[model samples]
Target chain A: MYITWMLAEGHTYKQMLPTTPGVFMGEMIVVTVVGADKPGIVAAISSVLAEAKANIVDISMTVLRGFFSMIMVVDISGAVTDLTDLRDRLERKGDEVGVKVMVLHEDVFRYMQKI
Target chain B: MTKYDASELAEIIEMLSFQHLDIRAVTMGINITGALRYDDLGEGVREIVEKHARGLRDAVKEVSSKLGVQIVTKRVAVTPVSVLLDAKAGDLNEAVRLGVSVAEALDSAAADLGVDYVGGYAAFVESGYSLGDRGVMESIPEALSSTERVTAMVNAASTLSGINMDAVYEMGSIVKETANLTGGRGCTRLGVFANAPEGTPFVPGAYHGRGEEDPVINVAVSGPGVIENVVRSLEDADLRTLHDAMKRAAFKVTRLGELVGREVANRLGVKFGSVDLSLAPSPAVGDSVADVLRAMGVEEPGAPGSVLALAVLTDAVKKGGAMATSSVGGLSGAFIPVSEDLGMAEAVRKGSLTLSSLEAMAAVCSTGLDMIVLPGDVEEHVIAAIIGDVMALGIVLDKSLGVRLIPVPGAREGDEVDFGGLLGKAPVMPVGRFSSKALVMRGGVVPPTVSRLMKG
Candidate 1:
């Protein structure tokens, strides 16, 4: 089924729903993780997203100047928790994994980089 | 998903986390003209301002958190109170009393609504003063001293209208009286301007002019530290290359400001006014325009090459910012407030930056003679002459300039006076030894520039 959401600009966007109960739709977010390379870093981050039902649409990982860095574009439409809660959970997970995580809305990138 | 390179993402993060990239102010310009229809002027102003500004702080917070950007201050600017009081007050005393009442209303509403400041307690008397203008001038010391969040400004000169030496002379004493009342702290919230723009987001000079929407969102972008970082990154780069780098950094910063401003306006259901590109600096280290000048190869802020360096920096910022957003207004240049900038205060302490040099630098930059502390015993005519000099520049150059001077009561030259918080602290700078009393005493009007004769 198609579901419509009111965007910040007052425009309506339609998304196809999975017909599963309690699944909702929301905005896109960018999660950036940076720190030293270590074991189970990806697992720890992805596990928190999995718990919140946030889908990782795209991700790129690299090491610059001997420090590990990862960028993930997340679709939080179906997340069980709000952006703030999810950010806190991911930050806590990043702390446990010895990294720094930043959560920002996707529009910050689109508006700043495009045109 | 929207496509952005990982490197671009990293640059954005670095700018925000380390370079002090943020919106300095999101000022909502609200028209309170309709308040005149009510019988009780103060109550009417309170109602209208409260209705408009109620959601400003919350809306700003919401957008700041959603975008992960820091919005430092949420403020409101209303229509000039003098315009509202023109027909309301019958005598000068009534005008002063009514002005204070309205100021109190604005102050209480701002306090309750969580707005940091409310501007537009002002009068525009470039040519001459109406009863309302005189009233606002007389009440300024009292209004500002009594209210915590109210700011006042006077536009006594403009390019087309010439300089109003009478108003300028009056403002000098108004500033002094305000200093006497508030230990010079009240003067910090006051400004005297030439060719004051209508859509400024900065405090003490912001106002909702006649052609503006009833409610609009105007944003001021501050990134002196970000520009300084870009300048420092280029080691031994030529001036041309330095300009290009600063321009590129300014483009990114302006883009961020426009984005945040539009989002906040959209949420508040108000028209987006403009994005000011002024590189406003704070008291914090690394966030100073003077430091940017120093990084540009000048030994100090007021060194020999300082004017050239400042002109280049201001031009590059304007060019890049113009490309980023079409709706640019306000004082879109670098603010060199001595007390508000650590580097500038340091320059004064080191005896490298004098008032004469600062005046020369003001001819090239924006916001003339801002946040400068003068000796308490200095004559009023000296302040008038200083303001008149800056006004002359504005008219001749056809640009916007403002003077915000604080004459600290009982403070001597070279004495450090701390206003604390974002107002910062600076040592009182010495003025000219000789008197300009005769020059200022011949008060009438300085004629408009010869450029006014030119036709389009």
Candidate 2:
């Protein structure tokens, strides 16, 4: 169950706070969310990641041909949960909000993309 | 700072999931020339084993975990065993035994360290055969047959020294003898090169040259399938657009290679060598340089426009790869190895790609007659002539080229030979029935080109 709240910027977010503290420090994961173009999707995803103390190091989101897509490199060093556990929490939020979420180690994106 | 938006991110995902994009090989070049002086050969082998044991294992673990990508094949290339034969002092039989023992030790050590292949069981006789070169040359047949992972190469031709037809002829016979000894398996591990590079990271040809550092890390990045997908998506795009897009793709691929290579080198405390951007293909369907060529509007590889297409593709890849990394080396061009490339194999199977056309492509591309399977009845002289022809191209163009032909014993023309995995499969193609016995039997070196002598 997700509780919704509105910010001063006229954006809505879900409350999915981290349940634990300091779970694998100095690690990162790449998160990608893709689904129908809709409001509150970014807010929902960011809220979940922030609640888990995952710092977004890099992010690129764009809507193409009426479909919403986003890719974020998040430092999960201070995460309160294991990577897969955090991914599971994000997936639940994704399910509730009607989007697809994929979580993988940041190295995957780094190996395929950056130098 | 490297921001990949939706489309670019999708491209990476799709390439990895469907197109089979991955690092082909991360070959570590180790200089074992210093190992030759030990009274007991076992001491040299132990030194090699100890040096590589922790370094390679730790790097592989950390890189795979941190980068979240497979390193694919872990390989080792050492100094050519021909140089080590100096210790044997003109004893051919004793050198052969020593070569076998050294190769077995190296192979066992490599296997123990979880390496895929160990190269540099080689003879460098581009000008003329030295005693040590001859010893290693004679031992190649047994050495390769006796070991699982040892790769051998013979540099029988180079631009400066011209073609050593004498060594070339012997290599042809040695190739046949190796096949006979190992039932065509050994020939796959042996390559004949002209102008072989000092920093090559790819197998059957890579060796720790005398000029290189004590130990270095070289990475070979491959993504023929990725390039194919990118090219195919732009249907009816102009040639310039196609070339530009392919360049962009290669730049990204090579960047990733440089990143991984540097990180691995830093962790292992060895200098980073080069990122080889050869579009090496596998047996898989979409992962072929021929597929990329086909996407460039060639109906089939080895067709009339195929050579030009390959030239453009090879040049564009180099331009992109050059911009991506400073230390780019090895055979950095599109490879049309027949057996290893699915589309090339299909082209051969359909009778669209012929031996002559493949040679023509090799003239413009990197290696020549790579992984081509020929009929068992093909004479030794004919094979020598084939190597001579490719060597002449490398000699004239002053570029690196190699030939890896497997004459499948008992297989006739149109017969299929399967070596499995990266060795892939090829259909035995017919060579000219005519023999060049007299020419090969000349057993003399072709002098350096006039251009070579003119270099003051």
Candidate closest to the true structure, highest lDDT? 1
- How would you encode candidate 1's per-residue C-alpha lDDT over B1-456 as one tens digit per residue? 446678877777777777778899999999998888899898999999989878898899889878888999989999999998897999999899999999999999999999999999999999999888988999999999999999999999999989999999988899999999999999999999999998999989899989888899999988999899889989789989999999988888899889988999999998999999999899988789999999999998888999999999999999889999998989998889999999999999999999889999999888999999999987788899999999999999998999999999999999999988888999999997887889988999999988666623
Cα error of candidate 2 at position B35, Å: 1.7
Where does candidate 2 stray beyond 4 Å? A1-28, A33-70, A80-115, B1-4
* Structure candidate 2, residue pairs in collision: A26-A77
Q: By DockQ, who's the top model here?
A: 1
- Superposition TM-score, candidate 1 onto the true structure: 0.93
iRMSD for every model: 5.3, 6.7
TM-score of chain A of 1: 0.73
